[model samples]
Target: MDLQIIQNRIIEIRGQRVMLDFHLAELYEVETKVLKQAVRRNIERFPEDFMFELTKSELDKLRSQTVTFDWKPTTYAPFVFTEQGVAMLSSVLKSKKAIRVNVEIIRAFVQLRKLAIQNSEIIHRIDEMEKKYDKQFKEVFTALRYLIHPPEKERRRIGYKK
Candidate 1:
């Protein structure tokens, strides 16, 4: 599977990087219901930290913000699996495809973590540079910060003049 496709399926929820049941099912080449049944049968393997059901509000927010073209709002809340939960799934699933998909998913998660670490290092180096430089470089650092983390929305026109 393409790493970018896997990475796109992984999302942040409640500050945790997770894959929803539907996505995992698609990757495992099983019906979502079948996957949920497997997880239910081996519920003990999943603790709160490993997996959790998305709350209605969380699901709504996710639907509103993300490309959930394949997913329609359903009465049942989706289950989200963290990295640990995904690792456990390989044992529960016990299929060659499941194992292979799990490996790819795990690699995607690892790549995301590595990127996060690299970004932090870059930010730290930028901070050190700012400290060494004077106020003259403040705008440069500000521009970098904006590039790294852009504002959610454009700022309103200040003191508007025709």
Candidate 2:
């Protein structure tokens, strides 16, 4: 039920934050096969927008870019659950731990949103500062270039070199 544990379950793949099926299974205290079976049995509950399987290329990209524990090319593609699908998981996975973990996961999603918004603001400020100082920086660069590399007319003769 720890938020940190749920937050750690989130991963960035395909340029979006998502939870992989195996990680969700572990969090819900179910075997990966069991969780996949439940999802398969209740496919209607998960629409394409709510849940989708990662393509082989997408999976490969994730594997290449991200560090993982005990990861292998899965026989079946991993399912990615969006916010709505995460909520639906509670209904499909009925257990005390599931309920508790689901709540933590929801909170983690909200925290992620807040963090993203905060990061956007920070990036915006950085962009503004960069824009404001760009002219000054260019002038400084020009001045430094002149100091470091003088004109051919200003070159001094090397007395020792033949």
Candidate 3:
């Protein structure tokens, strides 16, 4: 029900962001097996672009790296649902919670994209400012160095410490 919980389920897999089947099932308040079965029944709805099973290596890497789940290394690898796949899932899931959660997940993704774009723009502007000030900063430092240490001809002791 909480959007924040659903948003954190988004993860990067196979060079694209996706949601794992178990996380989706949890969000939908369904068992993982039920979710997988529903997807199987509506296989045509989910094309390769929409959903794909994780390769053994990929699954292994996820299991080893993630602290989130205690997934046993089963004979079958987990399925990943892309943005499109998530959208399609609502039709197959056939529950009020699934529908509401799907909508929330979509909104969360859009918000995430907006935040990423805003951050990138801020970083680009800061980089430009750094470049613009680099030469000016170097010149100021050079002038300060000269002021701190004058030529030998201009060097004269004003007073000696006792």
Candidate 4:
């Protein structure tokens, strides 16, 4: 599977990056219900940080804000699994397909982390350059503008010296 495909499924929720169970089920080629059942059977493996159920309102918010969410209305709030939770799934789901998909999913998560770090470093460098150049450029431009159109002479004090 393309890492980009997996990455696109990842979403930031509750201040952590997570993948919804349905998306993972689709990736694993299993029904969403079966996946949920497996997770419930291995609930101990998943802590609060590893997995959590969204509130009804939270799901609604996602549906409204993101075009990717085309979830039909359902009685149960869908569970979201974090990176660790996805890794833990490989153990519970012993099928070869599950294992393979899990590996790809883990890779996708790692790639995203790497990307975020790179972007942050890039932004920091950009900020440093801006700070270093802002004043110098301002002075240079001021000088150039002065030469191009020198400030108007003081108009002889407009007929009176205060």
Candidate 5:
């Protein structure tokens, strides 16, 4: 279980980091349907905050943006499992592979958290420095801000004569 591979499977939905059922099933070495069935059987173990089914519109938006290999061209939307939901899955799955994969998934989530915290710290330090240097480094700070958040694309004028 490579950490990068696991991290790539994790995505943001509704402002929460989550893993899709199909990705979890692949990591757990079980069929998607079987994994979903296990979760359904132990529904009480997973609360709304722990797990939720993707809405049709959300699924459609995801499909349009990325190639979801595991999802079939069917009407059923996928279930998303949060960090807590993924940790709970090990108990429901009751398999050595499931337990091992869950550990790796948890590690990936923790790594992401650490990276986010470090990023915020860096941004805070940059802000403090900018305040200390005031107008002296205004252009430099502006460039840094642009690097942090680039502007969105602008449409070109239509039917330009010259």
Candidate 6:
């Protein structure tokens, strides 16, 4: 499986990297229901940090940002799996396809981690350089830091705007 394909599916939720169950099922070539059933059967293997259901607000926030996925409000909030949770999935899902997909997914996560570390190092370097320079270059260094790690934008309200 392509690394970018898996990376695109990964999203940040609750300040942690996670993949939605539906996406995992798609990668595993299994129906979402079947995947959920298998997980339910092996609940002991997953812990809170490994996997957790999305809160209503989190689901709504995702739906508001995404247009490609028709995410209607369902009774059960979708479960999101962290990197560790995804690793555990291989044990629950005995199929060869599932195991292969799991490996690819883990690779994608590792690649993303590497990219994050690179950006952090770049940011650290900028900070060090900023301290050495006078006030004239202060703005330049600030801009560079922002470019490397942009701040989160304020989310708009869901109701109709006044």
Question: TM-scores, in order shown?
Answer: 0.92, 0.74, 0.77, 0.81, 0.89, 0.89
lDDT of each: 0.93, 0.82, 0.83, 0.87, 0.91, 0.90
Residue range 49-158, candidate 5, lDDT tens digits? 99999998898888866774555765568899999999999999999999999999999999999999998998898899999997999999889989987997885666
Candidate 3, residue 74: how far the Cα is off, in Å: 3.3
In model 5, where is the ten-residue run with the lowest total lDDT?
67-76
Better of 1 and 3 by TM-score: 1
What's the true lDDT of residue 105 in model 4? 96
Please give the distance, in angstroms, between residue 132's alpha carbon in candidate 6 and its true position after superposition: 0.7
Q: Candidate 4: misplaced stretches above 4 Å?
A: 137-162
Q: Candidate 3 at 45: error in angstroms?
A: 1.4
Candidate 3 lDDT by residue in tens digits, 9-127: 88889777789998888888898889999999999999998999999889879886687775755577888998899999999988898999899998888887897899778667655
lDDT of 6 by residue, 14-121 (tens): 899999998898899998889889999999999999999988898889987777664645578888999999999999999999999999999999999999999888
Per-residue CA lDDT of candidate 1, range 1-162, in tens?
A: 899999999999999999999999999999888999999999999999999999888988988778654876567899999999999999999999999999999999999999999999999999999998849799999999999999899657768689
TM-score of 4: 0.81
Q: TM-score rank, highest first?
A: 1, 5, 6, 4, 3, 2
Model 5's alpha-carbon lDDT is 0.91
Worst 10 residues of 2 by lDDT: 140-149
Clashes of each: 0, 0, 0, 0, 0, 0
- In model 4, pairs of residues that clash are none
Residue 60, candidate 2: how far off, in angstroms? Answer: 1.9
Per-residue lDDT tens digits for candidate 4, residues 39-135, read: 9998999999899999988988988768766686677889999999999989988999999999999999999999889977866765576578877
Q: Which ten residues in a row have the lowest lDDT in candidate 6?
A: 66-75
Q: Per-residue lDDT for 40-108 in model 2, tens only?
A: 999999998778999989887877656754585568988998877888999998888888888889999
